[model samples]
Target: MRYHINFGQNSSSFKLAVIRALTGILLMTALASCASQGAQEAELAAQEAARVAIEQEAASLAQEQERLRAAEISRQQQEQAAEQARLQAQRDRQAAEIQARADAERRQQEELQRQVRAREAAIAAVEAERQQKLDRITALEQQITSISASVGDSENNTEFLQQAISVAEELLDVLASEQEKYEDTDSQGNTLRPLAKDLIAELEARKDELIRRAGTQ
Candidate 1:
């Protein structure tokens, strides 16, 4: 009986030792697997972070390009506007200059002062009709030289003194027809409107030959 008891105690101790060894091996393997999983997860997280940074950088580049394009367009628009304004100003200046010139000759100096006052009123009405035909030809040459020297002595009625010598030779042919009408002349150098109507018909034929030689003296 004492020997059997000692054997039984030895068997129990061996079984316990086996159980402890198995537990230790299982725990070590589990720990190694967990550490490997953690390493893989860390690597994956680092790769993802790099991808996100690349995407953000690409977006920034695109935005910068768009901003530059918009600025260029705005600058071009401003340049065009400035050019238009310059052209408009030039046109206005030209128009103003034209208007000034138009008032130009101020109606060509009022039409040469109305043709010098109508040629000085037609030369003062032809010098007042040539001084009234030179004062009726100096009073008909002093009455035909005093009736041809008083009808050559007064027996006066030889048929009324021969009709008073044909009425004093028709009053010396009517004062030579007013000296041939004041010596003619024409072509606007005045004088001939038929020489003032033949000097008013030789002063009415020397007043009818001095009333027919004073009715035969």
Candidate 2:
């Protein structure tokens, strides 16, 4: 018997796949159209690697889901086989934990990659701006102008971080909204703590810098 995934076109999984495809396509298009051959080659390399990684992950997910469905069917059929059910339950739990880890790590990697790409694009914009003013500006003046531009770009970045934090908070609330069960420093908490900690540190650092810059101004 064949099993089908029931996630519809409107589902988050489908949306995520569309987003990933679009992102990869956009990145590769940008890399291909890059004016500088050196940058193009470098980005092409990175794009290929990312493509390979995404494909591998897709394959793994498909296999894992199939395995999960088969195991569920077997469990349902062998409800009277207590010993077999016990072993199957243990395996199912382990498989679930492994899948969760893989999903979390992939998400973290993708988020970090997007952040890096955003920063690089921002830096490129600042560099282009600096180049435009280079002929008329002194070295120190150009540096100052670039710094100002980057600071403006950082403000946009801060907003993205704020939105991410808000989403994370919402997810935390949803996970803990159990009626009878109490969750503590469990898997979700463990996954979130590092991210929350890092976000706070980065926001604090940005705040301090902005304060210092304001004082100078």
Candidate 3:
């Protein structure tokens, strides 16, 4: 009876040990499953953060590219404007040079015309002086011819003297008529006085000689 009692007590202790071990194993399994579920949630959060960062980087890159394009377009417009201004300045300078050359040519033509007028004026003055000299020479020649005719009549024979007397009388009558035309004017006509007096003296001498010869006959 003592031995059986001791065996029974030992069996009860063993069964209690087994029950405690089973309960400890079940608690360990539940704790492991909760840890695994927490690990999966942490991994999903990290992936979502990485995706958001990538989207932000892409947006920034697109904006930078748009800014570069706008800056290039503005630079091209400035270069074209500068080229157009340079061309306009060159054309204006060329037009100014042409105008200056035309003005110089006009002045040269006016100077040439002035020189031609001066030359013509000089020639006209010379022609007028020459005409005046010709008129003075013609008057002197007529006076000399009349003086020669009067001197020749004074040296003649009796028959020639009678014929000379008649001729002298006719010439005296014509001279008296011409003298009456100048009677109202002064001796400022000094050239006509000497010629008229010489003709009158010749006619008087011829008439006296003719009367003397006729009385002797």
Candidate 4:
């Protein structure tokens, strides 16, 4: 009876031990499955973070490219503007030079016209004076002829002396016209003097002779 009771107790303890071992195996399997699921979730989260970082990096690169392109375009535009300004300035300078040259030419033409008018006036004056001299010479010649024809008469001699003094004064007036020929170049037309030097000397001699005769009379 003692043996049988002992066997029964042993059988009961054996069954309890088998049940405890099965329960421990089931708990270990469940813990392993939970660990595996956590590991998978952590892996997915890492993948998602990597994708987000890559997208951000790509966006940053695209924005940098856009900024660089904008900067380059702006620089090109500035250069074009500068080139346009330079060309405009060059055109303005050319126009100004042309205008200045035209103005100078106009002034020169005006000055040349003034000189021409002045020359014409001087020539006219000289010609008029010469005509007056010729008329005076003709009158003097007629008077001289009459005086010589009546030379023996006493009244005629006195009249001849007075006529000679008048002729001398007329010749003195002509001397000033001849002097002006040298002073005013426009009057000197390729000759040293309008009248010959010998003719002037003869006239001077005639004047002195006439003056002496007038004083004696």
* Count of steric clashes across candidates, in order: 1, 0, 0, 0
List all candidate RMSDs to the true structure.
Answer: 11.7, 59.4, 16.6, 5.9
By TM-score, the candidates rank as 4, 3, 1, 2
The most accurate candidate by lDDT is 4
lDDT, each prediction: 0.61, 0.59, 0.61, 0.73
Identify the superior model by TM-score, candidate 1 or candidate 4.
Answer: 4
- Compose the digit string of candidate 1's lDDT tens values, residues 21-138: 8877888878878888888888788888888888888889889889988889988898889888888888888887887776666566665565455445444555555555455445
The residue-by-residue lDDT of candidate 2 on 1-217, one tens digit each, is 9988776755988789899999999999887777578787889999999999999999999999999999999997778588788898999999999999999999999999997787777656644543443432343244344444555556645443444444434433333332112222332222223223354345435544543454354
Off by over 4 Å in 3: 1-37, 114-217
Q: For candidate 3, which ten residues in a row score worst on lDDT?
A: 185-194
lDDT for model 2: 0.59
Off by over 4 Å in 4: 1-15, 139-217
Model 4 quality (TM-score): 0.64
